[model samples]
Target chain A: MKKSDVIRAVFHSLLQEAPNKVWQPQHEKGLGFAPTNIALCKYWGKRDIELNLPMTSSLSIALPDKGALTSVSLHDQSYDRIILNDQEVVRDSAFAVRTSQFLDLFRPQKTGYLQIDIKMNIPVAAGLASSACGFASLVSALNDLFDWKLKKQSLSILARLGSGSAARSFWNGFVEWYAGVRPDGMDSFGEPLAFEWPELCVGILTMSEVEKPISSREAMQRTVNSSLLYGSWPKKVAQDLAILKQAMQVTNFPLLGGTAESNALTMHATMLSSWPPVCYFMPETIAAMHKIWKSRKEGLELYFTQDAGPNLKLLFLEQDKEQVQQLFPSVDIVKVFE
Target chain B: MKKSDVIRAVFHSLLQEAPNKVWQPQHEKGLGFAPTNIALCKYWGKRDIELNLPMTSSLSIALPDKGALTSVSLHDQSYDRIILNDQEVVRDSAFAVRTSQFLDLFRPQKTGYLQIDIKMNIPVAAGLASSACGFASLVSALNDLFDWKLKKQSLSILARLGSGSAARSFWNGFVEWYAGVRPDGMDSFGEPLAFEWPELCVGILTMSEVEKPISSREAMQRTVNSSLLYGSWPKKVAQDLAILKQAMQVTNFPLLGGTAESNALTMHATMLSSWPPVCYFMPETIAAMHKIWKSRKEGLELYFTQDAGPNLKLLFLEQDKEQVQQLFPSVDIVKVFE
Candidate 1:
C-alpha cells in the first residue's frame, strides 16, 4: 500500500471520525521544535518500508538543544517552497524532493500548498539525525497550523511517514518506539520513559561533516536484503532494548553505555556483512574508536556509538566530561538531562 | 573432556587395536612441510572446544610455499627443545607452551623428549594462519618420526588437536573441513577438492605485523558466549560453503570472490557484535578496504577477505594481477594453484 493510505488510516484511527474537522487552518503560521535522538537500542531493519514499521522496538535519548526548528504557513503559490537554514532548497534536490513528497500526504486534495522553513543545529545527512528532527518538527508545526490538537503519540506516527527514527524525536528525554505488529502501524509511536538521570552526557566526536556516501534508508534496505547476519538483528535489538531500559531505570551508566555501543556496532556489523558491503567507517573513525577503547580500558567510563555515518557519539557521565574532553580535544559535549 | 583425553581417543579410534605397532621410529630424523590456508567460508564457533570440532564446515585454499617447515629428532636433553626460524623459542612463551603441550600428546612415554625446529615463511600471530601451518607441519613431522603412515584424514584430525584450522593445512590446494556429528570428532577432518583454478591469485595486503592483542581462540570463545548475532554464524557458513563449492566447480570468479569476502566479513561481524567487541581492523586496514571497494566500483575485479588480524587477502585473477598490484603497490601476490 502507498504511504498516503497508511497516513490517512493512522490519522483516522487517531482522530476518531474528527479528521475532517481538524483540516482547516486555525492560524496563519505555526512554529515547532524537536530534539534529535540517538538510539540506545538501534532501529536498523524495517518490517514495512511504506509505513516505516520497524522490525523490533528501539529506545533513544533526545539531545535537548541540538535538533531542528521548523516554521510552516499556508502558501498561495502553485508550488510549495522550502528553506533550510535560511537558504532556499532547490526544487530538484533530494532534500526538497523528499520533503515535498512527505508534504503531499497532507496537502488536502493537492490544492493546498505550504511553505516550510527549517533551521537545524546539527549537520544535515551526516548521521546526526537531521532528517529525523526536521520531519518531526514539520509535523508538529503542521499540527499547530491546522489546530489538529493531536497528542504527541499521534504526531510521532505522523512524522514516521517521512522517516522511521523521526517517531522517536517527538520527546525530549528517553523515548521508546514500539514496533507495532499491525499492518496499518497505528499502535507504533514514541512514548517517553519516566526515569531521568541529570548526570548523563553525550559527547559528539565529529570526524566528518560531509554527507554520507549512502543514505541510512538505502543502507538498511541493503542490509536486510543481502546480509546473512541481519537475520539475528531483531533478537539483538530486543535484548538491547531490555538492557537499555533497565540501565536507564537504575541509572547504571556503564550498563547503558556498553549496551548502546554494542548495539551500534552490531548494526554496523550487519552493514559490513551486506553484499557490496556498506562500510561507513572512515580511517579516522577507526582511529577515534581505538582511542575511546583505550581510554575506557584505562579506567575511564567512556563509550561511543556510531550511526550510519562516520561521526561518533560518546556516552559518559557528567563527572567524566573534563577527562573525555581532554582525551578528545575537539569533542562537543551535550548535557542530555539539562 | 580434557584436550589430552580427546587426543588419545582420536588416536585410538584411528589406529584401531594396534596403536602401539606404529610407535617405532623408521628414521633417525623426520622432516615435514605444510602450507598456510585462507578460508573462503570461515570456521568461527566450535561445537566442542576440547576436540576443536567446528559448529559448521568451512572451505579454504592453501597458499603453497608460504607456510612452515619442521624437523623433529629424538633429544637427549631432559626438556623438549624447540627452535622457530633458527631462534630458540623461550620456554615460557605462549607459542612454546602450546607447541610443547601438543607434543606431549605423542611423547610415547612421559620421559621421552624431542627437539623440534620450525621455519615459517609468513608472519606469526598476524592472521596469516601461521599457527595452522605450524601445527600441521608439527603433526606431519611427528607422524614421519613415528612412521605411523596414517592417511591425510587421520593426520588432519591429529593436527586439529593442536589448532582447529590446522586440519585444513595438510594439502596445497582447495580443502574443505567437515563439521561432523560424531561426539569423538572422528569424522571431522579436511579433504582436498578435485577442482583447481590455476588463474586464482591471493594478494596479501599486510596492514600490521604486530601480534594480535587477543588470540583467535579467545575471540571465538567470547563471540560464541556473548554475541547475540553469533547464533546465525553456522547458517552463514553453511550457505557460503555451498556457494563457494559451486563457484569453484564453474570457475565463477565474481561469485567465488563475493562469497569469500562476505563469509570473512560475516565472521568478523559476529566478533564485532560480541560484548566488549573484537575489532581487528586497524586504521590502515579500513583505509585499504575503502580503496579496494572504490577500485571494484571503478571496474577492477578485486575482492578481499580478512582473518583474525588486520591483514587483508585480496582475491583476484592472474589477468588483474597488474591492476591489483598497481592499486595496492605494497601488496605481495601469490598464485594459489601454483
Candidate 2:
C-alpha cells in the first residue's frame, strides 16, 4: 500500500470509532465560506497546545458575507495541493503544514489525493483572525464534499485543531467559546448566542495591511511565560466575562462596549509587560481610538477594541452607523446583526 | 505685612525651628547647577501626596555638569521675578507658580524680593527629567542666597516638594531614594551610593524634543487609580529592588541593565492598562529597543530604559562608549560616572 493508503486506513478507523456520526463522500467537489469573528472579550493564551484550547472563555460577533472561502475537490495527484488566495502555498510553510495536518483528520480507508484553494477577502496575519476564517471555511467545505453528517460542534472541534479562533467562526451572530473544564478538550467549542440586538455592528479601521512584526501565537506564549502582570489575569477575565455576558443578555450596548474595550486594554497590558515587549498599536490606531472616545463624549454611541494588530474596530448600533462612518470614513463597516 | 512678607516671616520661623542648622547670608546672590538623573528603577506612583513621598523606592544615576543652571539674587521688587532661559516666565504659568512655591521654603523675615534667572540646557517635559534638575538647581541657589545652612538631605526634601524626581538629582553618582514609612516624609530623600562602578554610563537617543502629551504626574495618578494590573506591582517592585541592589553590589552589568529594562516595561504596562491608556513609547522607541537587542546579540553590551517620553536611554559601560556612540551618533551623550 502507498502512503495515501496508510492515511486512508487510519482515517477510516477513526471515523468507525465514532459510530454515532459517519460521513460518506456525497460530492467530489464543493465550495464554502466562513466569516471572521471579532472577539469582544478576547481569547489570548492557550491552555492545551495539542487541542488549541483557550485559557479563558471569550465572546465575539460574527461578520458574515465577507471573509474567507475555500474550494476543495478530489485530485488525481499523489498528494494534497494547498493553494492560498490563488497562490500555491509552499509545502514547507507553516500554513501548508497545518492544512495537511487538518486534512489528515478526514482521510478514509481508501481514497485519492485532494486539492484545496483558498480565497481571503480580509487581511492575513494582521490580527484580523484571518486564520480563523480560513480554517473554518476549509473545514466547512470538507464537510460538504465528504457529506459529513458531523454536527456543528464536531466541525468546530475539527476546525480548532487548525486555529484556536476558528472554532468561533463556525457559529453566526454573537458566539461564546467556553474554556471548558475537560482536559481532553471534548467540551471546548463555540455556541451561537441565544439573544441578539438587531442594531449591533462593527466598523473596522485597517491601520496597516502588512503582516504584524510578531505573530499572535508568539506574543501569547511570550506573555504567558514572562509577563508578571499576566499571573492573575485569568481570574480577572472570568469576572469580566460574567459582566459582559450579563450585558449581552440585556442588550446593553454601552455596558457591552465598555467591557469589551476594557478587556482589550487588559490584553494589551499583558503583551506590553512581556519580556522584550510586544507593541502592536501604530500611531494611526491610537488616533482612531481617540476619535471614538471624543465622539462618544459628544453623545455618540461608540467604543473600540483591537486584537493583536494595529487596526481599531469600533462597536456601535446600526442607528448610529452614519455617525461612526463620519468618524472612520475610509474603513469598511461590517454589520454583525440584521 | 504683605503676603510675600508674611511668607518670609513664616519661612524664617521654620528655619529657626531647626536649631542645629542656621547660616546668615554672607552674600545676597548665588548661582547653582544640577544635572538630571535617570532612574534605573523608576518611582511612578506616590503615597504621601503632601510630602511627595514615593510609593516605591527607586535607584538612579545622576548626570552632572550638563543640566539646568539657576542664578538667584535678592531684589527690592514687590514680588519675585522669574526669568527662565532668558525669558520672563508668565506669572500665571505653571512654571512660575511652581518656582514661587519652591522659593517660599527660603523666605526670610523682612527680606527683600528675589529675582531668579534660570537657564535650562535640557529639554523640559520630554522625559529627560528637566524639572528634576531645574528644581534641584533652584533649591541649591536658594540655599546659598539665604544661607539656610541646610544639609544636602534637607535640599532633597525641599526639591521633592517641587518634583519627586528632583530629589534624586541632588546627589552625584549612583543614588537610591528611600520611600520612607514616616507620614511626615522626614526620612524620605535621595542618598548617594556607597559603592559605585565608575565605568558604568549611559547614551541617550532623544527621539523627540516636543513636550509629552500627558504629564507624568497625571499619568501616575491615572494608572494608580484605574489600572487593574497596578495593584500587585508595588510588591513586584520590592522584589526587583532587592535583585537590583544585589546586582549593583556585585557590579553585574547585565543583571543591572536587564532589571532596569524590565522595571521600565512593567511601568509602561501599568500605564497602558490605565482607563484612557497613558502610552508614551513612539514607534521610534520600539525601533531603538530592537536595535539595542540586536546589537547585544552581536556581542555588544547594551540595555535601555525610558521615562515619561519617547527618548530612549541606553546603558552600557564606558569601554563600549565608542560602539554606543556609533549606534546613536545624532543624540547627545551624558556621562553619569567617571
Candidate 3:
C-alpha cells in the first residue's frame, strides 16, 4: 500500500474523520520544536520499509535543548519552499525532495504549498538524529497550522511517516517506541514514560561533524539483508529494553550504562558482519573508545554508545560530570534530565 | 572422562596399543619443525572445550618457514626443563604449566624427564598462531623421540590437545580440520588439500607484539557462553568453508579474499556482542583496515583477516607484491605456496 493510504488510514482511526476536513488553517504561521533522542536500545531493523515500522521496540532518552525548531506558513508557489539553518535548500536536492514528500502527507486542500524553515541545534546527518527532530517538529508545526489539536501519540505516528526514529522525538524525557504487529502501523507510536532521573546526563563526543558516508537508513537495510548476526538483533533489543527500563526505574546507573553501551556495540557488530562490511569507526573513533575503556577500568564510571556515524554519546550520571568532562575536555555535555 | 583418559584412548585407537608400550626411545635427541597457519574460514566457538573440538569445520593456509622449531632430549633431572629461544622458562609460568600438563599424557616410564628447546620465527601471542605451531612441533618432536611412526592425522589430533588450531598446523599448504561428531574427538584432524596456488601470498601487518589481555581460549569461552550472536556462528563457518574450498578449487583470488575477510569479521562480531565486549581492534588496526578498504575501492586487490589480537594478515597475490608493498611499506610478505 502507498504511504498516503497508510496515513489516511491512521488519521481515520485516530480522529474518526478525513485529514482534509480537519486540516483547517487557524493561523497564517505556526512554530514548533522537538527534542532529539538517543536510543538506549537501538532501532536497527525494519519490519515495514515504506511505513517506517521497526522490527523491535526501542527505548531512548531525549536531549532537553538539542533538537530542531521549525516554522511553517502557507505559500503562494506551486511547489513547497524549504530553508535549513537560514540557507535555502535547492529544489532538486535529496533533503528538499524528502522534505517535500513528507509534506505531501499533510497538504491542506485549500492551501497546497508551504514554506518550511528548520533550525537544528546539532549537526545534520552525523548520527545526531537531526532528521528525527526535524521531521517531528515539522509534524508538530503542521498540527498547529491546521489546529488539529492531536495528542503526542498521533503526532508521533505522523512524524514516523518521514523517519522511523522521529516517532520517539516527541517527548523530552525517557520514551519507548512500540514496534506494533499491524502491517499498516496503526499502533506503532512513542509513549513517554513517567519515571525520571533528574541526575542523568549525556555527553556528545563529536569525532566528525561532516555527513556520514552511509546513511543509517541504508545501513540498517544492508545489515538486515546481509548480516548473518542480524537474526539475533531483536532478541538483543528485547533484553536491553527490559534492563534499561528496570535500571531507570531504580536509578541504577551502571546497569543502565553497561546495557546501553553493549546494545550499541551489538548494533555495530551486525553492521560489521554485512557483506562488503559497513565499518563506521574511524581511527579517532577507536582511539576515543580505548580511552573511555581505560578510564572506566581505572575506576571511572564512564560508558559510551555509538550511532551509525563516527561520533559517540557518553552515558554518565551528573555526579561524574566533572570527571568525565575533565577526561574528555572537548565533550559537549547535555543534561538529559534537565 | 579425564583428559588423560581421553588421550590414552585416542592413542590406543590409533596405534592399537597403549601409549607407553610404543614410547620406546629410538634416539637420545629428536628435532621437529612446523609452519604456522592462518584460517580463511575461522574457528570461533567450540562444541567440546575439553577435547578442543570445534563447533564447525575450518579452512586455513599455512605460512611456510614462519613457524616453530623444537628440539627434545632425555634429561637426568627429576622435572622437565623448558627453554624458549635460548631462555629457560620458569616452571610456574602459564606456558610451562600448559606444556607440562600436555606432556603428562605422553610421559614414558623409561624417560621420566626431558628438556625441550623451542624457537619461533613469528612473535608469540600476537595473533600469529604461534601456539598452534609450537604445539604441533612439540607433538612432532615427541613422535620422532619415541620412534612412533604415526601418520599426520594422528599427530594433528595429538597437537590439538594443547591448542585447537594446532590440528590444522601439521600441513604446509591449505588444510581443512574436520569437526568430528565423536565425544572422544577421534575423527577430528587436519587433512591437507591438494590444490596449489603458486601465486598466493600473505603479508603480515603486525600492529602489536605484546600478549593479548585475554587469551583466545578465554575469549572463545566467553563468546560461546555469553554472546547471543554466537548462535549463528556455526552456520557462518559452514557457508564460508564451502566458499573457501570452491574459491581454492577454481583459483579465484577475489572470492577467497572476500570470503576470508568476511569470515574473520563475523568472528570478531560475535566477540563484540559478548559481555564486557572483547574488542581486538586498536586505533592503528582500524586505520589499516580503512586504508586497505580505500585502496581496494581505487583498484587494489588487497584484503585482510584478523585473529584474536590487533594484528592483521593481508591476503593478496604475488603479482601485486610490489604494489601492495608500496601501499603498505612495512608489510612483511611471504609466498605461501613456495
TM-score of candidate 3 restricted to chain B? 0.97
Report the lDDT of model 1 for residue A30.
80
Per-residue lDDT of model 2, residues B1-338, tens digit only:
45344434434444675533343444767777888899889999998665578999998888876679988887777777889888888987877877776665555444556788989877888999988999899888877876677778877877887789998888888888889887656678899988777888778789899989888988999988888888868876887788888998898998898888888888988887777767787767766877787798799988888999989888888899898888888856676766
Cα displacement (angstroms), candidate 1, residue B187, comes to: 0.9
The C-alpha lDDT values of all candidates are: 0.90, 0.80, 0.90
Flag regions of model 3 displaced more than 4 Å: A1-3, A15-18, A21-24, A108-111, B17-23, B108-111
> What ordering of candidates by DockQ runs from best to worst?
1, 3, 2
> In model 2, what are the clashing residue pairs, if there are any?
A8-A108
* Runs of candidate 2 exceeding 4 Å displacement: A1-24, A74-78, A103-113, A246-255, A283-302, A316-329, B1-17, B20-26, B73-79, B102-114, B195-201, B246-254, B283-301, B317-329
TM-score between candidate 2 and the true structure: 0.86
**Model 3 TM-score on chain A:** 0.96
For residues A1-338, write the lDDT of model 2, one tens digit per residue. Answer: 55344434434443564543343446868677898999998998998676678898888889886689998888878677888878888888877877777676556434545789899988888989998999899888877887765677877877876789998998778888888887656678899888777788888889899999888988999999888888767866887788888998787989888888888988988887777777786767766766776687799988888999989888888999887777777868887766
- Report the lDDT of model 3 for residue A160: 91
- Candidate chain B TM-scores, in order: 0.97, 0.90, 0.97
Q: For candidate 2, what is the DockQ-based docking class? A: acceptable
Chain A TM-score for each candidate, in the given order?
A: 0.97, 0.90, 0.96
**For model 2, what is the C-alpha lDDT against the true structure?**
0.80
Best prediction by DockQ? 1
TM-score of 1: 0.97
